[model samples]
Target: MSVRAQLFAASLSALSLLTATGALAQQGGLDPAKLGLNANENLRALAGSSNTAMVFDNRYEGIKGTPYAIPRWLPAKLALTSNIPVASVLLKYDVYKQRLLIRDPSRPDSLLLDANKVTGFALTDPSAPDVATGQPRVRQFRRFAEAPVATQKAEFVEVLYEGKYSLLRRYAKEMEKADYKGAYSTDQRFDELTDKSIYYLRSPEGAVAPVKLNLKALQAAAPSLAPALKAEGSKRPLKTAEDAASLLRAAEGQ
Candidate 1:
């Protein structure tokens, strides 16, 4: 095999080991007893629930940097028809190959969106108390992804927010019912439930196969994983799915 191929194999091996260690730690499944009891149980609990099956074929892209800049090709294809303030849009494209490469912070790139291009839109509230003055607080509805020319891949509409639970619920509900007419033909693939669970599995050649666990296990491990979680908090320490993925990627790299 070529040197490139060997590196690929090594990365896969590391990924496999990371997954295996995670699975072994979750052998007993999501145990409430393991995580300290707290009133936030509804948010933290993930035991004895229906096994939510996920299609692993989903792709992801890493959108990093302070001022975000999405590729015109992919972002133009995402359908943002929901009439709600988008909290955060989660795209699952392959980040390794398609990281939205950050430009010079002093001279960041910008993509303009025409009225016809977006399905919906919103602007940040200027009247809102200045949490971080001088930081650009404008919010806009941008595209996320599109279906292949032949395949019927669904476009996900993620709502961005910066408020408490009531505000979250209000916007989430509006997004759940918004009419999404994107590259994808149907809404069957769209998920509206804000509190759904998902999981992933990993394997490496000639290595021990590992079991699988979902977000529940991570939540179960949160209280105990406080130290790790706290130390890594600055680098997106487990608030969002993308943050959690970053944490896992960092751990796997080590």
Candidate 2:
């Protein structure tokens, strides 16, 4: 095969794998207990009794609006609590509204899972590319809710790095509006959807505290490892969450 043909074949193979994974997740044949759930707990009971599904309306008035985040339907395992059975379903995270949307097997429409009820969740997608390495990435997100602290509210934060001192990423979204003037008239409308990735540090004492994505913030969070982190940052540019994770791992001597 030619070089272009080889590349196209590889792309097709990757797409096929992703499609199969999504189909399996949506069809719901996977055992919940095997997915890290308590075997004795009732799976159907934990899924709740609600039949109403939340629909995402992308049309504002008559105009089509863009989604706040890339719409990804992935296989996910959700835990309500240790006592309740973990539910395995196809879920989508709405970064715009900070909501977990689920397509229940019994429901025709997508339903919003209660954020407060969710203890944690894991999403797996095989189609994404790794940020650090330019290879095909099986993206996995493991997030858990922490108790509200004085500085931050209780919300699901993704575990970026876990050690004596851990790094977490929190996602928040806000709507921006502006006045759009047409040829005939003007009207106020949503200009864009803005999202923020806020990083936090979990101390060895198990307290969670917010930290900015900067070397100074990392140093402040771990005063003992300040000099080491600064050295690491000097070696390589610390510009993203992945860079921060690399720094943390180095500082911890992992």
Candidate 3:
């Protein structure tokens, strides 16, 4: 063969070898066996195993699975359970003897038990106009008198509010049974049912000012309950007398 032809054949062979090597590299050149990774390490390569374990633990070992979790809290919150619209707000005394049945309009079979009773405060018909709206038909809490309802949703959407209150009442009853004082109080400060005496008017800067209450008289009547009454009175302004009167009853004969 001529030297030029021989050189051409050698070049063609080298090109073929290079093409074959590139094809092999693309195919499976990165074998794990060559990399010294064992089967156990390979198993650890699977995604979400740790995440799955965390989820499993959270599901079974957390607040969701405890006895107090499902029936006491969940039943009252979920839509599938007893759902009723709040026809009206009632005080603990008003609800004490009365059997307030919360029936699910969707499921007649599902009715909530013992939802009406309330303590520490109650909702009453305003004896006079709201200082703001000057309308008696509007509802409000005697205590925490800023606005009868905490959120606008609780005011307009009766069912949602009622459902929330139902759950709250359930929790409250549990607390009362367990003697949890904090349960009766709330960060909200104002709710549908509140002691009238414990209310105050909201100042321009959002400070609480006690409504028209003869503190001297309340103090004279019951010295021990005075501090509690005063604290309660200061939470929200009882813009009206009816609100104050409800609170006054607690101090009577003190």
Instruction: Provide backbone clash counts, one per model.
Output: 13, 0, 12
Please report how far candidate 2 places residue 169 from its true position, in Å.
1.4
Ranking by lDDT: 2, 3, 1
lDDT of 3 by residue, 1-254 (tens): 99999878866865665566556656867564533453344445433247455432221221111121112111122121134433432222222222223344456353444432321222223453544456542322122223334631111111001110110111111111212126564333212322211323333343333333455544444455568668766755554444454455433322
lDDT of 3 at 198: 30
When summed lDDT is taken over every stretch of 10 residues in candidate 1, the lowest stretch is: 163-172
Best candidate according to TM-score? 2
Q: In angstroms, how far off is 159's CA in candidate 2?
A: 1.3
What do the candidate models score in CA lDDT, each in turn?
A: 0.34, 0.69, 0.34
Give one digit per residue, the lDDT tens place, for model 2 in 1-254: 89999877866865665566556666987664443343222344344477778897453544234442336677787767554876588887676566788886777899888876776676665676566676654333444345355333545667778888988877666656655556654565546656665778988887777888889999999887898898888887788887888889888888
List candidate 2 stretches off by more than 4 Å. Answer: 1-70, 82-87, 95-98, 104-108, 127-154, 181-189
- Which regions in candidate 3 have their CA more than 4 angstroms from the true location? 1-37, 45-209, 212-214, 217-254
Best by lDDT: 2
Which residue pairs show collisions in model 2?
none
> Per-residue alpha-carbon lDDT of model 1 for 1-254, expressed as tens digits?
99999878866865665566557558956454533233244333323256667666332222222222222222122334454443332222212222222222345463333334345333343433333465434444332223221221121223232211000101111113323347764533343323222222211221111112323443344334445534555565355534454454443442
Looking at model 3, which ten-residue stretch has the lowest summed lDDT?
158-167
